[model samples]
Target: METTEADGSLREAAGKVQQAAGDLLGDAGVQVSGKARELRAKAQQLYADLASVARESTLERPLTALAIAAGAGFILGLLRAASRQNRD
Candidate 1:
């Protein structure tokens, strides 16, 4: 009877330990998920900041730069056309 009692007590202790381990793992998973979300949000904010700066800063003003590029391309095309004709 004493041996059986000892075995039962051991089994109960093991069950309690398993439950505690499961709880700890669940809490750790929640913490990791929360941290991942926080990092992702921060990354998104950084991307937005960079994009806004690129779009609005004088060095990268989109429409003016685009017009300059188009004008240069058109001039190059005109030069190419003049250079390609046969003189004879």
Candidate 2:
């Protein structure tokens, strides 16, 4: 998790540098690529944060976590079944 956070930070920093270079060179492609990279890094960081929270929650109340997981799985199964029915 720490490694992931560090990597995300590095990626964000690199992206900012890329964006700045693009701006200086007047290149639309580089700018777009850099923006995408920055967004991805942010998303990664967000996921890591969420995962850490979830981990702590699970440790605090494991049965609740299990129930939630089961409910989510059941809902996903139902959704998949409905999609298949529609296709058929």
Candidate 3:
């Protein structure tokens, strides 16, 4: 497994244990904190998975990757400009 996947798994396991402890002790704060940690770990794992896929795709098709990146950048720039106009 990748380092990020391993770390995320460990973090998720810790969160589960914390959540169970909170449930046994009836501590809402601990329960909420554990739940948040679990969610963050899941998100981290998902990001790692997506990054791996993106890396592979980029390697397999560099031109396609460049095009997609350019398109995404253009869209982000437009969104930023729109946000600035709204703020002004």
The numbered model that scores best in TM-score is 2
| C-alpha lDDT score of every prediction, in listed order | 0.61, 0.92, 0.95
Q: lDDT by residue for model 3 over 1-87, one digit each (tens)?
A: 899999999999999988988999999999999999998999999999999999999999999999999999999999999999999
Per-residue lDDT tens digits for candidate 2, residues 1-88, read 5888888999998898898889999999999999999989998888888888999999999999999999999999999999999999
Give the C-alpha miss distance for residue 31 in model 2, angstroms: 1.1
lDDT of 3: 0.95
Q: Report the lDDT tens digits of candidate 1 across residue range 20-86.
A: 5656787765555555544554555566666666656647677786887899999999888888864
- When 1 and 2 are scored with lDDT, the better candidate is 2
C-alpha RMSD by candidate, in order: 22.6, 2.2, 2.7
Better of 1 and 2 by TM-score: 2
Residue pairs in candidate 2 whose N, alpha carbon or C atoms collide under 3 angstroms: none
lDDT of 3 at 66: 99
Ranking by TM-score: 2, 3, 1
Q: Could you estimate the TM-score for every candidate?
A: 0.39, 0.82, 0.81
